[model samples]
Target: MNWKKAMTATVAISTCALLMSSTIWAHGYIEQPASRAYKGSNALGLNTNVGSAQYEPQSIEALKGYPSAGPTDGHIASGGVAGFGPLDDQTSTRWHKTDIKTGALKVQWKLTAQHATASWKYYITKQGWNPNEPLKRSTLQEIAVINDKGAKPAANVSHTINIPSDRSGYHVILGVWDISDTANAFYQVIDVNITGQGTGGTTPTTPTDPGQPSANAWSPSMIYVGGDTVSYDGKTYRAKWWTSGEMPGHSDVWELLAGLQ
Candidate 1:
């Protein structure tokens, strides 16, 4: 092959390699106070089935506009990506909550790859939002927002977020690391114990009844007969008929029984 032809072939291969690596090596996640991805990661010696998220915690990269455009309501935790689906599973008991007090708290990010930053926004769940419910824009209120004006961030990016004093129990803090160089942004959810106590910052009893809201998770392969009930994303649903494989909320086979608890 001629020199120019060989150079073109080499460039094509390098471009393909770069694109593939970008998709896999995602960028960053909260490190201190343990974001969900870090809490259940294999590298941390933490053992929890978070799918690929356990292996690649920094990869929760998603679209940029968070409250308005990005990864819709029910899929915030996983950055609306299918590979990190386990992060979307909602349950107060499912994730490890970090003990935190309201006021000035330092949150740190573990960046595997740094990019030109647009902004770093922090939002906390609304005062009464259910811990078991999937995170939504309506359920969260912004606590802090910082823009770098498209400057590349340092290797270690830490922010001092002043949590609202009125919060209590288990609350999720959604952090969006906006990348100025790209259309995507990285997301991380920090399950914080506002009162710095137990799982909820207060002792709470586990519900015994399977019928209780969020007591049982919906499994796609599990067959359900008419009148059968189950929970998904903190909502209770009743099977309108013998249904299997179809998911609740997304299908007509399941009827909405009740809202989040």
Candidate 2:
């Protein structure tokens, strides 16, 4: 059996199946414009605070035991680049804060029901989206649990996510308390891409929007990705990738990466 040939074919097939749109560039890059809201910081920057709220709740390394060698998901040091970690529980009951002067976020994850009976839940918020005080019990935002894989619905499987039109933070949480008693109950990957738009109804000031050309816009020369593996600094750790087409549902084969053109 041609193992090498088989592996090459597998990757190609996976990429194709993951991306069905003709407009999406294969391994292209998207540039973030300068900010009209905040000065100095790139109009847009990607972030996933390690051990912070930005990470999927139950899927952290210490919790999931995924490999931590590279800048991919599950790598503690890699996440250091993006600041991936559990977040301090917010005291604010109804809202979280996000600095969207730059871009909005898309989070994707893979899930498997270890015991064939497990269930998962997800939520989103911003850095200041929440306040230290509680709100009317009904005002607290509820984390939506996704159980459909792919864009279409499936049985006992769920996937895909969309950011709220006005939410501050984006978050995903998975748990098997409803399915398995043991670990290794499921296999999945979590991917995220930060694009220059938010539910806040605002766009960057680039001459043209990213993935497009416009006048007086910051022509994106190139964007560099630095993560925990390259540097020990916790401030810049994060995994990077690219994407195209509409946002992916959790079960979809492809989750857009930041490097996507």
Candidate 3:
């Protein structure tokens, strides 16, 4: 009877350890826009020196409640995991950027192991934040949040969130997926370059190409991009890149046109 009891106790301890190990390893990453983790994977190979994340793209699990109780500043991109520490490196060119626009965006996640969810929140680095330094909460502003109410998300899930029209230029988006059943959440950072005239609510005028004619004489106040043409003093001139207030033939930025009759 004593020998049988000892065997049972050992088996119970081993099984409990196995379960804990599996639960702690639950992970996932953003698919759409291609998160830093997803980009670092062996499958895509968008980045190098990714460390363990290259083999396990979804392994960035961290404590729940981001910005308040989550990973430390400067390490948010890596979920504060030592093995994935390379992701915490910051630079304007450190990570590739996804071209994004203002308004509604569809963000998708590839969950290798789904769990009961509490909420999935998204935040973006505020405009004028330094790109050469590690990301911090003070530089981020909440963009969207989805409350899942402890329901198990699908193996693949997408959320439609509206990006504000005030953000422009380079920005970093931080996504946090809170697991209702665990003490952890998955952290993913997405680098993006925003275009379009934000807050202006007006369509950005397309730059005139080589073959397009200028509507009128170049105004000193008018901004001109490459390939923009203007007719001034009975001659046609082509302007290059922000050629404002410069006479068509006086500066190298404007070239005299010969083919137009």
Off by over 4 Å in 3: 1-24, 197-261
Ranking by TM-score: 3, 1, 2
lDDT of 1: 0.77
lDDT of each: 0.77, 0.26, 0.79
Off by over 4 Å in 2: 1-106, 110-117, 126-128, 131-140, 148-158, 168-261
TM-score for every candidate vs. truth? 0.67, 0.25, 0.67
Question: Clash pairs of candidate 3?
Answer: 226-241
lDDT of 3 by residue, 1-261 (tens): 999999999999999999778656757899898998889899899988988789877989889988789899999999898789999999999898888887767788888887888888889898789999989899889877666557666677666556678788888988899999989999999988888543322211233454656547777766544446788777778754333577877887677765665
Ranking 1 against 3 by lDDT, winner: 3
Residue 217 of model 2: what lDDT?
Answer: 15
- Comparison by lDDT, 2 against 3, better one: 3
